[model samples]
Target chain A: MSKQVFIPRDSLNQALERLSSKMNVWVPAASGSNKCGSEFVPYRPDLIPLLNRQTTTPPKAVVFPQVETLLSYEYTKDPDNPSRVKIQLDDTSAGSPTLIFGARPCDARGFLLFDQVFTRGPFTDKYYRDRRENSYFATLVCLEWDSACFCSSVGSGPTDMEGSDLRVTPLKDGYLVEALNERAEPILSLMEGDVPTDAQQQDARKLQEEASRQRVGNVDLTRSATDFKGRFEDKAYWRAMVSQCLSCGVCTFVCPTCYCFSITDEMQGLKGERLRSWDSCMFFQYTLEASGHNPRPTRFERYRNRVGHKFSFIPEKYNGMIGCCGCGRCIRSCPVSIDIRRVVENLKENACVCA
Target chain B: MEASATTRLHQEVEASIGRLSTVLGWGAGYDPLHMTPLFVRSPEDIARLVWNPLCVQNLTGYLVKSPGVQPPEEGKKIGICVRGCDSRSLVALIQEKLISRENLYIIGIPCRGTVDIRRLMNESGLSNIRSVRIEKDLLIVDDANGAHNLPLERFLARRCLRCRHPNPVIHDVLLDEPVTPRTTAEDAYRDVESLEAQSLDQRRAFWSVELDRCLRCYACRNACPLCICQNRCIAETRDPRWLTQRVNLPEKFLYHFIHALHLAGRCTECGECERVCPMEIPVTLIKEKLNQITRDLLHYEAGLDPEAVPPLLTFNPAEAGI
Candidate 1:
């Protein structure tokens, strides 16, 4: 437990402004072209965070960028031996401390799964480790849940603060802010807030208590590793479920915990860069072989791999830690509204039957 | 629509579906303001079919894209539901011979406009919505709070505001009496005109800011009915090497160019690309500008006549030798 304080709603921007001067701060801001959507951007003096709604894209990029340069290289002709050429390598990793404000609890929880892959690896990924160790999360105690949200079903909830460094609970006209870790304590002073009154403290507790009990999604998604494994070979089942899928990358791109990537070498003259970019198993090219043989040749097979990788493969590999945090961005942003909750829940039972 | 109208539509559609390979239509989604495309092969699923301003997706892509509607068996037809804008895609597909006209049973619905759920949520601050329906010129939304009435025209999609084809150009079964179009053809390119009014630098800045937010999820391309390349799209191909995997502004700009330019003379302006974009980047404006140029320079309109070839694709033998 840490100290608690209250920052009025109007002063929230001032607190973020001050935090930005100390370290990199990301706040959810409305897109220039559309007011209905938002993305995380660096905080400026006049920037106001969209506290009411979730961002279209998560702050996952702050720790692991969408596209990252692993290393840069240049080839030069050797002076002493003309037949041999010299290769110069430059390390591209430059770690910096960052703070992500206004992240939903589900959004913050995504990092835990990422940590499992990047930090506890057979060989620790230096690029991911550098950013992961230096970043802090100031997650909001989520008060809203819609049809797509299912954090509670995934062993987490709206008020689940397992991965957050700071927990911010919304109040009537202000916020009740609490530091959950020593690294986040310094930010409370930066908020320039007053001590919460007894009434305000009660309000904060009631909100979290109510949220904790709420059923965001009416399904149990945990313990699905066996169910998924049992049905992996049921080709008829998989085909029926994914017949309507467009095989677009929307679901993977919007997912907070989906971290699959492909590395490519981009060359220009004498210099070249080794880059890593996000990849989706839904696409046909994701598993295309050099000889033009594709292991997952059809869209249904690709989609099955995606579902398996999240629920079954990760648990089999990582001691039962689920790959999904269930922020539901994938569901909400999907053009066809393919509900993943329905798919995962129905994993325990037969969803569709055909001849 | 009136309750009787909905009933009549369902009954008629249900009666005609016995011989179709599949009947493509809209079904209830996770929420009131969302709808999903449904392929109805049985009478039980017909009850799930719905029609409203919330029906936003253009389902014509299923006719041509793989894993979509498969080719009908000999002498069988593929049933589809199309609004005013979707009908144009059918004509374009027929014009290019992508889908035979004789093999379709189109149930056409006259459209006023489809609601933009994002715009409605942003403007009304509405959340936890339980129900939404249209009554005359107003949209009635019900949430945890009581019902709130809003003017429908102001909340219509940006593309809908300038719609010049509210009546399906071609149809086998017309659902309703045709409604008046929102704008005349002269005012059709108003969105492009405003963008053109800006200086060159201003235009560049506008696009730079918008494209910088693209995730390259390819939702817009997949949603487009005329983007027929599918798995062979140039944006994803290594053989052509047109683009890298970089998520920077230059790569994003080029990808948008590939999407817009490929449909330069063929875009039906259904607004699916703009609607499906999670970033809400107003991508349709890029295609609209090209459409304006095609209309002015080539003196042509696409998806209007099934037999007419697009100006860009029309062959000139004397110039082709070069």
Candidate 2:
């Protein structure tokens, strides 16, 4: 058996506390006092982290928060020439080194899409780039697959190690933590655990094997882009699929892979700050042009774009990296439970033909 | 097996689909614990219709919201399924003239409290569940690992616990025998009262933490049946500039208060706002507090009598104890 570091469940918080002195340690914590809602939060002494199940909100906020100030600006007028305004800007929102302690593999995989848009592009967003580069993910090998999780269907799995700096596997009494690369090596010592016994290592291996073997769904989305293209003009098909959708931003807000945002200047008199907040394609204002015409006027067209962007357009544009991570937050958090998997599958098979 | 109550309801909807444009109901989701709002257009679609404790969604919003089921022709009407709480929303819509009574065919189900799936899952440690069914007072959950029977009373939603109207106040057709209400009108605001009994600072602290967690997804506003200002909502409109895009605690507090105050006396306590909240914030509690104030000051309850206008909507100078 390979030797590995094991952090006992009891002392896991102590190790995390020790790590926090070095950098911000984010863990999957209950949103309030209830376990029903979970999000990645900066670790505190009293906070009991949730490592058992998938969090309600992803760790995307670590790199790209829902709403953040891009820059603060102020306007000043000279006494002699009041008409001439001087603009002073402050871009002080620098990112600190962060360690997301209990991110799932699907959560880690979502950053790859962000990297494609923010880092690999010609005009890089400095705020996102700094956070993306400084953040390291200790992804947990997900053993608890609910109906909402479809990581395997989207080319990611419970143990899929893409974009993960460290691998954390839960054992009965502790977690077997291992650094996948050199950058992650230092954090292992910060976990402050003893080397795993042969028996403990064997047990973790068995769990790893079990997690890798599990399958969530059998649907093949290999021909999704082409199929979606074929049915792009079928308005009736799209209408039937998402008729129950409430057109709320829950799906996109909870999604780890949805990286769309809108920038606006929030001003209080002469003092102003540019803010970047999360935006959803489901809303009417998303496609509203300056000419007062909206291309995606209704929920039907907007929802169609949502499906097309993830399965068809993103893959075609980004060299075959589908925008969806299939973390299943879109399905789980949808007020009406409009399954994206079902919609994508139906894109290939026209609803008219079946009904 | 005998035809269940849900199956019988589906049979009735199948027969009525010939005279209706579409029937709004609940269908099976990816799992048994969750239910999706189903829109049935044809006879074949009626089979998807379900009526059970898991059918927790309040479907009245679809009448006024997106892809609404209006009359296809002048003569034909639209069909809708409503629980006791949902029927109240339906009544409120009719009272406001958002939907006319003549254009609807209502299918009412007297609800005996729906399960709080999140709470049930949390307390029971049930995940990836296979099936959930009601057997009298117990809820049987099949999670592949084992079958666990949980008491139904322990998992009821907080709104359902305080429900004073378990039977539909307005319905063209009643599906089941009406059940007795769990609480009286005088004690219906017990939960809100407990929160009120706390010191003002304590309540403020509680809401400060709860509202701070808001992602500003606007799910609560979207799910509410009384919020008819869909695209023109002030919360999203930058032209008027009531609030900024900043998601700080102050912005969240303003947004929630605006949502609750907009419903003042119109909110029927359907609990859809609380149900749809992804963060599990008890947003409906805010609206209920408004309803309590309206109740005491005006001696009124919304949606019980469609003919009576909400006191807040109209100016009555002669209103007692003003």
Candidate 3:
């Protein structure tokens, strides 16, 4: 039987501290006093996690960081041969046991897509694999959602527990926690709380049921890919849809499923490091070939590719599972207010006419 | 007065819709508190246009963006709405000959101050807003919970706090009477001055902390009207690569420096770079410092005079001292 426990409101910090002691823990916290938004930060005793709201920046950095050093190298003159140089390589992995507390279901679901790309492929990324094997998620059953949230439309919901190791539902005075998998068993044992009463379990169940029924967005995007491909050649449609698009990477940066990255070697004299960082298809350089030919030249082609990659291309490759998790960060963070749902829905309307 | 301004704007746009291939204006977004750029092709779409404090975007950047609003086949013009700051961007573009003045029909609106949605939400603690309206110097926000009345200054954008040009510099059709500027030129550089007062180490520490959070989304670059090298930006070029793919502090600092230096004499103080930043970094301050240098050394201000060339773009052979 799965273990169930209740961590009272006052004891929440204590529970987090205990969890941190056992493993590296991360929680959604405000970036700073001057900044208006929050992001996933390493847990500290004084840091109060913003559990009620979605983080402005997703927790993808925990696994796929914005910048990570793949390896470092140094060159030195060899004593045996003056003409030849000796090379020293730094190739140590930094993965450790980690616990991500209070992640929303949408944030946790992002890892499922990452797993498909990094873990299930022939060329598995050792860095991503190491982090994936060591981390655990204690996702909160999300009841709070904004207009930007459309988790329900893309086959996910506020209360979906597809990838959570443990499920937590806030109650009147405490949070009811249920261990969903074996990874959460040790943490559950360390938690100093009483087993949740039968009545409390019923309350959590009711909250989950209501949250699942709530509709976040109105659009049904099951066949979004097919519709997008049908209108691929319609330049007028693309122009009208994304005319105000700043051609910036805000949408992709805030998106939970976007995993495009670029690698480069940074050197200063005899020392150098190979680094990998997040990249966006919205950028003009994303498709710039070494020979100076770019297939996706303008923002029109780039925007179309972004929509296609998520809804059409990924689904075709990944057994009809759409790449977008529908967390609504793209819509919320867009400087021009370009709604993806509206764009995808419009795709179906203009396809037949254009063809 | 505001109601008449809105009416006048609508009538002017409606009148020009037939002669113009497209009319660029603001429309209601997902919510009433937000406004998105509206592309009005026909007279029917003109009804969608609205003018209010929520119209914060500097729409002039669209004039230079690729695959932009095309001109009609039979010598028709393109109509665009410009606020005080936006008109300056248009002026800068026109001065650079990026767009022809004859092809554009400018409908200029006198702006009191545009609302910063982040600041408004923080001040009022209001979200899920149903509607928002500006009455005199007060912002009234209504949500499902209740209504909130906030002082306009408390929720004004950082750019509006020191706005020196509330009235457009040039316009084909003026939408309303000129509005008084919110601040004087003297009070414009207080934020920059305060930063200058700090020690070099303190300033370095401050910037390091701020720029460390940048996701390198490039929203700041894309929103800027002066940054014309859109697809061929030096930051992304490989042959003479100025910046690496590394997201370190040094790379971030250098990238920002390149951006600032490129806009040294050309920036129109539109505040689009700072406004569009997701991390809310005060990016405009960098450009402001450069503008201050140009103002002091060359006695020049950008986007003010269409005939005057940018200080750096043209050289004065007789200029001595160097």
Candidate 4:
């Protein structure tokens, strides 16, 4: 049996505090003034984690931040040889061990897709790899799902423990914590909790079984990628599905698996830093060329590319792992309430018609 | 009474459906509590149209956005449904000559106020909503748990709370009786006054904390009908780049400053920027402060008069004296 501990409801904060002392800890907590809504914030002793509700902002930023400085450089004139200049460069490779507490399975699975692009590739992104190497995820088994949630549709379930270092399942009084990997064993040992009895362990197993069996979304997207390619040239279909898209980056910004980024050099008088920030395919500038020619100039084409990237391209390249984790933040946060499930499912029906 | 108003709105659109090549309006979303912008190409599509406080989107931006269904003829007009604030956006578009008034058949609706979804969820402590109903000043929300009754004032969008215009200033056809304005001109700047009263450092600290949470998604800029520089926004421009892609507090602050400065004299107080912000940042407050300055300095209010030019857009050589 995996090393298991039972933390009572009141001791949850104390446990988080203990974890924070060893390493940086992030937990889902209320953001701004919205008590019902949550975002992943750095855990403090005073902060209360909202484990029952899904965070509005995904925990992807914990691994891949919205903005990161790769390196900083300064150029100075050489007194010995005025013709040549001396360059000083500062490499930013320093990273501390991080524990992302209260991340849902869907949020944890997002990193699995990101791993294919960043760490598992021939040319690995060292910056991302450094963060990935140092981070550990304590993912909660999701039981509460709203209309917008559809994690199961994209091959991830509420109880899916694919990328989790620690599996946390909520109990009536507290939580049942199980260490999944070697990295989590130290943290599990530090937790001030009683070893869970066989009854508690059985209860957790039952809950996980029930959660795994539940279907949150109504679409069967097994052949979604093949269907998406068939409708690539169908502008009328794309227009019908995504006409209300505001071309805003809300969908991409809130998405867990969207890893598209743009790198730029920022310079102040003599010193400068190269920065990488999140970029969205939905933006017109994402495809804007040097010659002022944009292949995806309109919302229709841009929306199509977004759907295709998640459903077709990524799955083809990464061996059938759909880019979308289907946490449904995009559906919930979208100004126009455009449903991606309906769009992707429509593509499948169109393929059937053609077949 | 609200039901009757919705019925009357349907009747008016049904009557005008034949003459209109396309009618832009709000329709039922995935849930009843929400509404999505709908494009009505035929009379059959009119049934999807809905009118309620939940219809929060300012549909004026669609006039500039290319539509899938085009007009039958080159000069044939497109129909649009506008609320009090949305009408101002339409007038501003006409004033700038970006869209001609002749090419639009405006269907105006006097709005009481739109509910902020975030506020409603917070106030009611309820999600997974089955349905929502507005009666007088109370909002009734039904979910799987039970029914919740919340006061309208507690849940109204921040912009709607201080709305000075509840009736459309200009429209081809008025669908309902004019609704009374929720707030007066004197009360409009209360929040702005409070923010201004703070010491410089206190004010700086206030914004620094709030703006630090911004993801720099640019949803606020994209949702604004007046922000016409869709693709070439200075925030994203590379040549002579005004701002870097850094997600730091200073860069975020500068991006908002650029957004506010660009709309110094032109913002119509539509509140779409604040509404669409996923971070719940009070972005419209910055625009309101700018508007307050313009009101005091130049005695100008934007989107009120179609014939009048924006004060910043035009200069008076004789009145250069402060």
lDDT of 3 by residue, A1-355 (tens): 4488999888988988988888989999888887678889999999988787888888888978888999999999887898999899997776898888889999999889899998898898998889888888899999887767888888988888998898989898889988998878888877777778888889989988888788877788867887888889988888878887889999999888999988888888989998888889999878778888889988889999999998999999888888888898898788988888877888996332210
Kindly give the number of clashing pairs for every candidate.
Answer: 0, 0, 0, 0
User: Compared with the true structure, what per-residue lDDT tens digits does model 2 show for residues A173-277?
Assistant: 999998888888888887778888888889888999998998765675545899898888987787788888888899999998998898889999899999999
Q: Write the per-residue lDDT of candidate 2 for residues B1-322, one digit (tens) a residue.
A: 0137697788779778888988889888878888898888878888777888878888999899866665556678889998899999998999899898998889988888988888888788887688788887788889867899998999999889999898899998888889999999889888799999999999999899889988889999988999989988889888898989989999999999999999999999999899889999889989989998988888889998889888887887777945
Q: What DockQ do the predictions score, one after another?
A: 0.57, 0.70, 0.53, 0.50
A-chain TM-score of every model: 0.95, 0.96, 0.95, 0.96
- The number of residue pairs in model 3 that clash at the backbone is 0
TM-score, every prediction: 0.95, 0.97, 0.94, 0.95
Candidate 2 chain A, poorest ten consecutive residues by summed lDDT: A346-355
For each candidate, the alpha-carbon lDDT, in order, equals 0.85, 0.86, 0.85, 0.86
Per-residue CA lDDT of model 1 for A1-355, tens digit only, reads: 3388898898888877778888899988887644678888999987778877778888888888989999999999888988899999997686787899889988898888898988898888999999988888888989877768888788898898988988999889988999998988887777777889999999999998998888777787877888887788887677556666777888998888989898888888989999999898877789788899998987778888888888888888888878888888988998888777766666775554421
Residue A109: error of model 2 in Å? 0.8
- Docking quality band of candidate 4, CAPRI definitions: medium
Of all native A–B interface contacts, model 4 reproduces a fraction of 0.57
User: What is residue A20's positional error in candidate 1, in angstroms?
Assistant: 1.7
Weakest ten-residue segment in model 3 chain B by summed lDDT: B118-127
Q: Which pairs clash in the backbone of model 2? A: none
